[model samples]
Target: MTSIEPITLTGKFVTLEPLSQEHHHGLVDAARDGDLWKLWYTSVPTPEGMAAEIDRRLGLQSQGTMVPFATRSNTTGKLIGMTTYMNIDAETPRLEIGSTWNAASAHGTGTNPDSKLLLLRHAFETLGCPAVEFRTHWMNQQSREAIARLGAKQDGVLRNHSRSKDGALRDTVVFSILEHEWPAVRNGLEFRLAKYSA
Candidate 1:
């Protein structure tokens, strides 16, 4: 599929739409909830920052290195978050789900888990990728725990991986799910969704 084509991936509870201008306003509204970007390790902090972020992601897409999405809750038809496949190695059939942020309403709900299931299904089954990666700041306890719940194995920590927005040195926590591990990961996600729904 052409990278520019509007890709729509839906799971039982969430849908991922290819990032577009139409999604900008809704995402901004969703992000209006406070301190979103205040987290030292998170990418976004304000609605105004989204435009530049969107442009950056689109620029990467032009180079075939990233695909970003505006996450919507299928149940409520509300824009809830954003996610992306970054550092995409199409030749090696691998991509990373990073630069992710969710509205407060999305947390502790089925939105994130189901959103991930939809993306993972596309990455592994549709794209036929051999692996998928999920990375977070090493000290981001919430993100680290969420990644673990996805059944991804912690590969290792990349110390001094990058500079954080706050100018602090970042230690990256890397995790991955190999093709051979998709079955269990998929099942775990389904279970998590079920629990959320129940």
Candidate 2:
């Protein structure tokens, strides 16, 4: 199944590898860079919870419901974050790219965009998926803007979509890019990446 495959996706700035225990320490350091776990709307794991989080993701992978990745920086050769193709529906051929977080240092450094380029390319070109979804907490304006920057259109908000780990109700903002729209999105990503190279 397209959504269940474990594969590496490489880009100019980042490489997406199958998440493993070996990435545990690097991920802890990356998460600590910005104390990302402090963000109320996000589910970023604290250093102490990193291993359990990895286990959860791997468990989901074993169930054929998610494909997780450890994102490593090409320049630093360091794990900077994690991402995944989750909420997978193989029959519909759709997957949601979620649970993504990066080190503070990797922000605005071409890491995010290039990583998206690779994921989007794989989802559309390799997997032949008709659409891919992205969801974030409504309170996370940074993530919403970043998703829009990748040429995804807002699909609407799901009020009280789910309960967060802290027992708070989460309003999820969903966005998506369709297969037919991939060409334009690809062009936009390439154009954005060009600026970093320049």
> How many residue pairs clash in each candidate at the backbone level?
2, 0
Candidate 1 global Cα RMSD: 1.9
What lDDT would candidate 1 get against the real structure? 0.85
Top candidate, metric lDDT: 2
Which residue pairs overlap in candidate 1's backbone? 37-44, 37-45
Estimate, for each residue in 84-109, the C-alpha lDDT of model 1 and write its tens digit.
98888877778898888888877887
Give lDDT tens digits, candidate 2, residues 1-198: 534589999998999999999999999999999999998988899999999999999999998889999999999899999999998888778899999999998999999999889998998898878999999999999999999999999999999999998999999999999999999999999999988852
Question: Candidate 1 at 104: error in angstroms?
Answer: 0.5
TM-score of each: 0.94, 0.97
- Once fitted onto the true fold, the runs of candidate 2 whose alpha carbons sit more than 4 angstroms away are 1-3
Q: Measured by C-alpha RMSD in angstroms, how accurate is candidate 2?
A: 1.2
